[model samples]
Target: MDSKKSIHLLYAQYLANKISKDDLALLLDQLASMSTEELALLTAKFHSSEQISDLKNTEFNSQKTLAFIQDKIVVEEPRKRNKFTAWNTIIALAASISIFLLFKVIYQKDSSLFRATQDSSLSSISNQAYLSLILPSGETLHYSKDLQLLSNNSLALPTKDVKLNVLEKGQLAFEFSLEFIEKFKNKTYLIATGSQASCTIRLMDGTLVNMNGKSSIQLPTIFSKEFRTIALHGEAFFDVSHHKTWPFKISAKETEITVLGTSFNVKAYQSDSHVLTSLSSGSVALDNGTHQVKLTPGMEGYATKSKGEFNTRKISIQEIGMWRSGFFTFHEEPIIDIIQKLAQWYDIDDIQVVNDHRETFSGSLSKDKSLTQILKQLEKVSNSKFEITERRILIMR
Candidate 1:
């Protein structure tokens, strides 16, 4: 009559509904004393696909019993028990916490734990009121400004509202209230975003556009049409929400990307003569106002303005769109190209390439990292020497 064997028999009988109603109530009452680690183990076991399926396909009130069990799985640890449970309830508990901890160990031998999702009221919007974006070039810009940077666009504000601020030479922001959005229906709501380098925006339909530095997104004052649309100049990345009912469309330089649903990132900088569209999921068509090239996942379609031609090739997602993620993700990019990106993000007026073709580098870096940090990493990885002055950086390989 081993204690572990006796407990297993009791647990199995309880699962089989052989336990009485009073016994069930007593078990539920013991739940409040469980520890975080114990509860986490229980959660891991309860959320298993096999257990969930068993609970679902079973008959004879099994679903109710399972729900009841899951609800009682959350319990505060001994040290933090005072935070969640009443002191009276804590002392009156019949079962020892050790038994529960053993039960958890047996049920969740290998699964990991995750935090519980809290329920929220339905009145909230997904948008953030304020956010600071650091571009791949190292420019941290606050895109909260009046609608002044955008031509032919206007903003509506509350009576005593705080006017948004755009740091020294940063771009503008546009966050319209639902009411204002409704008022401007059909009319275009345009605004500039990104640092002297790049910026991003989420459309009404949940699609995101990364605005390469010095680009604008043209939107309807209010979205009423089926299509989510945008225009680009420099470069941009798009994780277009899959809207099978309507197409997500983007026009950049001389190229256009059209898809009903997909995960693709686009880059069309001014110095580059082409629009590079990299796909992550689904399919997209890259058109040069006349001819179009279809792209599959892992492939990038390059449409050049000079040749008026479309070329498709496979590329890594990190290599192209990491700019939106606040880092310069480069793959075989030349030193000159790296310098140009550094120039844009650091807001350097000019770059002197002491030795351009003699050197090149590759690596990932946080856009928020100071010039000194970036230079150090760059110098180390590229096997080059970096000399830093007040606002200029010199690289010698």
Candidate 2:
């Protein structure tokens, strides 16, 4: 057999947990000697094969295999030879497997493992620690003070000797200090939260906004007499003050939401495939130029960028602002999607899903919990296992 076919056979045996020690050594030797182009072709073949589909159900301990490969595979340095080593071969194999698993999970269809049911018992997870103020001039100001100060409804600014107060009902009243009023007036400001931070701000019109982690809201220092408009780039809960004549408008990617007065949640993250607007009270209209839909209390409207059309669904009113109270509520959400949310909240830098069964999850989790705690609960409810190393998280079945 050709070297390519031989390598494929060995890899298949390895996956089946049927490879002998001598065969494993021979496979590593062949992989280390192969060129980059040849390795790429092998990876492509692995990706297209049906063997990968059976990975999720395999009983082999991949963690132990990886550990053994790392510890046992060592190629002695040669005086005048190619640079490839056993370590390089192991890394390449590991990367190829990871890529295959991720692609399979993301694109797999007609698989029962993808189906998920709701679990009412699960709670939520936690967030990062910094908030920032970006001025229109491009200067970014970091809030370096203790976030706990906000709990007392007043934050003392050590840099400016001013008190930034959180008004009743969790509204961050920036207008309380004359210094802030003078500085922010007439200029546009972008309030941003870090990967593990959430913020609440009171707009000039008394509209309360609770911003989720890794989110931002851009607004002028003052609203125009005819309209109150803001642009959102992430998720937020809005409680708009009543204004019959002046309409509150929000531009979230392709969707534009118009409201006279209402309390609702807008999840418009650029990374998300859809812009979701869920209402808790009053009424709001969602338009994306191509289509328009009006939402009443307990209704949720969503639009995708690719389709540019609006769709509506019914949700519990209590689920509207669950994020504000440090909880995440999901309904038949994909596992990858849930991990993306957890990555944002925990400031995780890298994510890898291996041997994914394409499972979906539904439930609630408290944001106050640790990453380990959240993943433990998730493991109990699903067939996946989670591993964390530094800032990276790995999901496997």
Candidate 3:
């Protein structure tokens, strides 16, 4: 049954003055999962309905329950119908207050919520956060979930210039030392760009780093032919400085790659539980803690959640790295999963279902298009309908 329809049925009974106390408690449980956007549209649709005021009378610990449910930041609380202290009890008792209050006691204790970690300390477990970064140079940088800092070699950065500093989270800026570069090969300089920014450092050793946005890199304000190396987090496109005798080492989120100067890209976001490394120009060996996979250009390596399950396979280069072009393209992705991607992109937290498993979809959807337009196209293909409320999308069957 549609939970919304069930809620309305219960509300209708209240308005008709025929509802027992238990049905009222059941409705409160349903309201807890309602997002702020859901509540606004709900109130708008029902404001003129006579059931509105009657439902207001349905009390949770009297006035306290009302205040809690109506609070702007209410978290979802699953409301299942109580098996006991329901209409059966109402019928057993001859319309007495004694039986009704006992029903409230039986129901209220279980629904009480104690928020253990408030917003400030919830970063570790929370998908949402108010992240900001500050530079040692006193500049502010916006933070992205996938941002990395790399320190290796740069034309301008004297090899391993330890003094280079990143001022903020999303800002890309690096410095090179001329002292190390004065005697180095190409006499190149280090560069830093912004979110989704790219840094291409042409070192004396002829190596490169394509820093993806929200990424940073530093180098030897000097260069060495013996060993070419750098560290990374977030994502970066790399074409290492080749040296047969000197191996280039790249490190990120508990994964490392040592190569004889090859070409590849690592999209290892610290926020991501797994690291995705794609070979682009040359062969590179990938490592998770215990397992390692070696890949030639055009192959990909994935380290799974379980420690021993590292997997390596080949993927289309264009599909995996399309975000560099400011878009995400999906192929053969499930309709529900597609909606989920949209939800995260728009920062939406509400996605309701028609509770069916057989529906799925295809076709290219734009990230820049409206949620309604995308959903509408999907609905047309699946021969289904959907309801949109502010940021939420509900599948209608």
Give the per-residue lDDT digits (tens) of candidate 3, residues 239-311: 7766789887665655667788677778764345677788876688876546777888679887776445568
Q: Where is model 1 more than 4 Å wrong at Cα?
A: 1-183, 194-200, 210-215, 224-226, 317-320, 354-358, 380-397
lDDT value, residue 218 of candidate 3? 34
Tell me how many residue pairs clash in candidate 1: 6
For residue 26, what is the lDDT in candidate 1? Answer: 50
**lDDT at 300 for candidate 2?**
96
User: Order of all candidates by TM-score, from best down to worst?
Assistant: 2, 1, 3
Show model 3 residue runs off by greater than 4 Å.
1-207, 211-227, 317-320, 335-397
Give the per-residue lDDT digits (tens) of candidate 1, residues 1-397. Answer: 6643544444444555454434444555444444556455454643454543343211112223334344444332224444235433433332323234333443343221100000011011111112332211122223333323222112332422223333333433345556544554444534444344454466657666666554445555444455666555446677777878888777665566789887777766555557778888889987664577898888998855544678778877546566776787666777767766766566444555566465546676788887678777776666567676765667676
For each candidate, what TM-score against the reference?
Answer: 0.51, 0.60, 0.43
Q: Which candidate number has the best TM-score?
A: 2
For model 2, residues 1-397, the per-residue Cα lDDT tens digits are: 8876799898776655555546766775676565556655665665655645545322222233444454454443233334455445544555544444333343333221211100110001112336665443444445533544222112333345233466786556554245654665555556667776777888878888988887777776567777887878778999999999999988776677999999999997656788899999999998775688999999998875554677788999988878787887787887878988888677787889788567777888999899999999999999889999999989898
Model 3: lDDT of residue 149: 27
TM-score of predicted model 3? 0.43
What value of lDDT does candidate 1 attain over all alpha carbons? 0.52
